[model samples]
Target chain A: MARPDNARYQETHEWGRLEKDGTVTIGITDFAVDQLNDLTFVDLPEKGDKVTRGEAFGEIESVKAVSDLISPVSGKIVAVNDGVDGDDFSALKKDAFGAGWLIKVKPDNAKELDKAKSLADYEKQLAEEAH
Target chain B: MQETPLRAEHERLGARMVDFAGWYMPVTYTNIMEEHRRVRTKVGLFDVSHMGRYWFSGRDHIKFIDKLVTNDRAGMKPGQIRYSLMLNGQGGALDDVLVYGAGDDATMLVVNAGNRPKIWDWIQRQRKGFVVDVTDMSTDYAMIALQGPESANLLNKVSEVDTKALKYYRFTRGTVFGEPEVLVSRTGYTGEDGFELIMPQAKAAYFWRELLNVGESLGAGPAGLGARDTLRLEAGMPLYGHELEEHINPLEAGLDWAVKLEKEDFIGKDATVAIKAKGLEHRLVGLNIAGKRIPRQGQDVLRDGKKVGTIASGTKSPWLDEIIATAFVPANMAEVGMSFQLEFPGKGTRTMKPEEMRQTALVVPMPFYKRPGKK
Candidate 1:
């Protein structure tokens, strides 16, 4: 999945693409969706709500089990992409990079981005996980 | 404690392996929901070799097992099948099983995976005076279940043997995939119409590959124990350990129909009679997700802030799009349309009323999802 150069990934399989405007576009990674099976209901965070790093923002209710969506960065929910709520689950399969985007956040601090994994590092990390 | 012939196949498919009744088995392949949705909408392949099979022979064998099981096996013709239970001396279930009257003296008992040894011993003890030979064919045999609406068509293609004559709960033994020792039974754990194929252990992999190849056009997936649990739960069927055990009687588990009170004799009849006169305390019933989360087995059942019983098996119903569970509730609360509260994560106590009534799960029996008739 393609992303902005400045974005980072969480080891738990969530990705955050930090836009130039200091807002970050967030969604669970492709690996997370596969691990979760068919996505049935995604509870997106309300726009303007606040979430903390490593805390649950909402939940993604898969048919088999429900998993909490954690915020990779502490921030106020600036906007949530309506695509997931719009029922284009094929996005998670087709254009998971762009159209499958979940929520956007204005990070509390720019340096907090350092806590995430780089693209090359995340790929190698996923490789190690594959082994 | 032994794994099925598909252990390597399961691992290759990235199945999440767990110890079920001591046998290391795959609980899921890919994801449970993925497999479950595929089964509901399409077809699913199941490796069911873990179940135990016993063949009974001798003239008295018919009378022997008929007295043991609750089903009216004495009246069954060859190729006919019946679902029944083996009761203990006190009328409690030894195990819920499928009995096939292969011939006048030829009877077969398919038992649960966990209770093979115990049930085998029970059968031996009962055979003290009867002139019969009981052979444990489980180790030598393997079983596969092709479940879902399309399963029948897929299985029919693999074998030229007549299937149109076969109705529900009937069996016919013949060759499948060039293997001569095949028995196709019109039965399954999944609610969908399907067939269970039994073959020798050595020929299992061959049959597996054949089924996958032919069933590919039918949209069959290698379903694991996880999706099997979800599918069976949706059907409101009982799991041996969770929904049934020696400590619990069939009456409480809503298996009273399997108890033949008029039978000349069987284990557990006397106990069941006594218990029936005394009345039942708890009734096993289906509980729709009382809250945001699903109820798991062994979780305490509550009524009026007091403990009543406990949950046995549960899952989030893909069809219902809600958490659903089966629990043992007080006999009174078990009535159709009864309401109760269940504790869930974040959501403390939530009271939800059952949407239906109990009648073969038709009323409040909690089928949870309405389904069309099979092809």
Candidate 2:
């Protein structure tokens, strides 16, 4: 799978990208979506909700299991993707890094992006974990 | 882990395997949703060899089984099949099983895989005064099910058996695929026209591959345990561990039709009689969720804000395109159209609204997706 060049990745498989404004776009990685098999439900945090870094913001359920969606960066939610919360989630599978973005957050600290892994580093981490 | 005769073939087909009841079996050949949809609309083959099979025979075989099971076995004719429950002395279910009468002096039991050893030991301990001998036949034979609307037509193209004439819950010993003698029974867990075939373990793989070859041309493909579960759940079939359990009585589990209360002395008769007189405290009912979120087993069932019961078996119904579940609630509260809330515990946040996390459900009649002519 191709990791997007514009996004910074977290160890827990979430991705965050700095926008033109002070806000950031966040979503789970394609690798995470693949591990979940078929996505049945994506519970997203409400807009204006306060989120802390490395904490769970919502949950995602597959047919067989449920997983927590961990936040990659601490911020205030500026926008939420209502389409992803709807019945069909094929868009999430088809474009994990593009239209599948879960939420937009106004970051508490923009420098937190420095701690996020680059595309190459995230791919390397995934390769190392495969062993 | 134990492997079925078709285990290697499943792996070669790129099936996703999982450990199920000590056996390495295919949970899905491809995607679960696609496989589930295939069985609902077309035909699908399933390898169910992991279930425990046992044979019983002697002068006292019929008498012993009649005394042990909750269903009447004395009136069963040769080649008849009946679904029954074996209960403990407390009227709790031991296991729900299918009793097949091979003859007046012989019978067979097909039981759940996880409870095979326990059921064997329980029956054997009660055989001291009987003349019957119980033999475990699980390894000697392998089984497969061809299920869906097109099952009979698919089988007719490959087998000599008169598939169209076979009645539901009846079996015939006949040759299949021109190979060897096998027992073909018109029975299935999915609410569809189907057949379960039992053959010698040595010939199982050969027949499996042959069936797939012919069946594929007819739009039939190999399904797996994942599809099997969704199909059965949509059909309102009770799974052993989920709906039926050691402490769950058959009466409360909505299996009163299988329990013969007036039959000559049987296990749990006294307890069942007393319970019947007093009426049941709880009853199983089907819940149809209004929206998309699927309720899972062990989730709390509530009325208003108070917990009323717990979910037993639940699934996202591929046929209905909705979420359906089976739960036990107070007998008085189990009427159709009764509303309730399924409370799924939020994992991370205590900040989410209670209404946001819970899904509304209503009680509905069971066998949720029953096919026409499925008695």
Candidate 3:
């Protein structure tokens, strides 16, 4: 469950990385992937769908339950991961930082401080918590 | 939170522990879906040692039990076990359990782990006459459910008793793994052909390890609670806390078959009869989610725009690879091929397909499922 070098993380365990033209790629972190395993189906929003921060944009169906995929940042869905459909879901853990990227988003605020924090910062936040 | 004796073993296996009904139990080992798949495709062992055990004794034990539980204990043979529910005077379920008559004077009752204290209190209150001494022996005993495809074969390797002659729902009490163990019933909460081995606390871990070793060449693996839920869901079985609770009666939950109206008398018998005569408005039904989304407990079940029922339990079947759910709907919606929309809390609403739902789920008919034979 190690953090990848290129991706930044949200407090909600989402990882994101900005592309060349400022389009951001977003997906859940490795820790999140490990937490919700054996995903049978994913309900992602349409490519042009609008999402708000703290709102659920989709759902993930595991064996015992279906949990919501809460949006970590307000954005417009530009592209969903091509591999999320059918049975090509290897990236959810294998290359979670890259191919597992859920969608490309144009943030509501281009200059907004991304919710993603550094790896050490994320680890520190979890460490301070009372589990 | 309380810990079972197998808590150490679960932790050692890298299980993800969760707080289940005030007990710290393993929710999964690798992951719920993978564990679910493992059990369906091959074998999965489960450490269900936390479940409660009660021993009813004395000369009138059979009479006491016949008047205690909702099942028809009068006709129940010595070696046969029956799934039954202990009900309150109001017909509300106190706890569901498996009843195995060790002897006419001694009968063993395996109750849910969480409801041990409640059921014991109820038992003490009910045992007034008939010379039955109710004893709570849960702490002294441990139970292991060796479920899935290869359970019978694996048990045959170690036990002296002839398990092949032992039919389903039957048990043969004898020595097992060098312990004073009772291997009478192949009944378990999981929907599989499996045997539940009961023993004293001292010899439990050794038997569990030995079973794992015994099933090694046959591809048997230790399963967690994750797969158990999925297997039961796939077979359209009801969970106690979710589907059958203190506020829920067996009749309303579609478990009236467990309650015998022909019996002389039992706890909640009159109330069950009254409820049956007056009829029930809400009844539990199985759901096959139309879309990919799964509906979990506490979620609302809707139709058109009306609130119909609430989801009691839900899971994605690893065998079928579809979302399965149990919900208590109105009598009208309880029928097969009745389409309803479900609004999952936190997750958006999805319309359930009526034809697909009915084809996928039945009314939890008799036996529910005929488990795949191990040997």
- In terms of lDDT, the best-performing candidate is 2
lDDT for each residue of candidate 3 in B84-116, tens digit (9 for 90 to 100): 988888988988888987756578888888898
- Candidates ranked by lDDT, best first? 2, 1, 3
State the number of backbone clashes in model 1. Answer: 12
lDDT against the true structure, per candidate, is 0.77, 0.86, 0.74
The CAPRI classification for model 2 reads as acceptable
TM-score winner between candidates 1 and 2: 2
Estimate, for each residue in B1-33, the C-alpha lDDT of model 2 and write its tens digit.
788999878978888777898888888787678
Per-prediction TM-score? 0.75, 0.88, 0.86
Over 4 Å off, model 3: A5-8, A18-23, A46-50, A75-78, A85-88, A108-117, A124-131, B59-61, B128-131, B182-184, B343-369, B372-375
lDDT of 2 at A116: 88
Best by DockQ: 3
Poorest stretch of ten by lDDT in candidate 2 chain B: B347-356
DockQ of each: 0.12, 0.26, 0.35
User: Cα deviation in Å at residue B94, candidate 3?
Assistant: 1.7
What TM-score describes the B chain of model 3? 0.91
* Quality of model 3 by C-alpha lDDT: 0.74
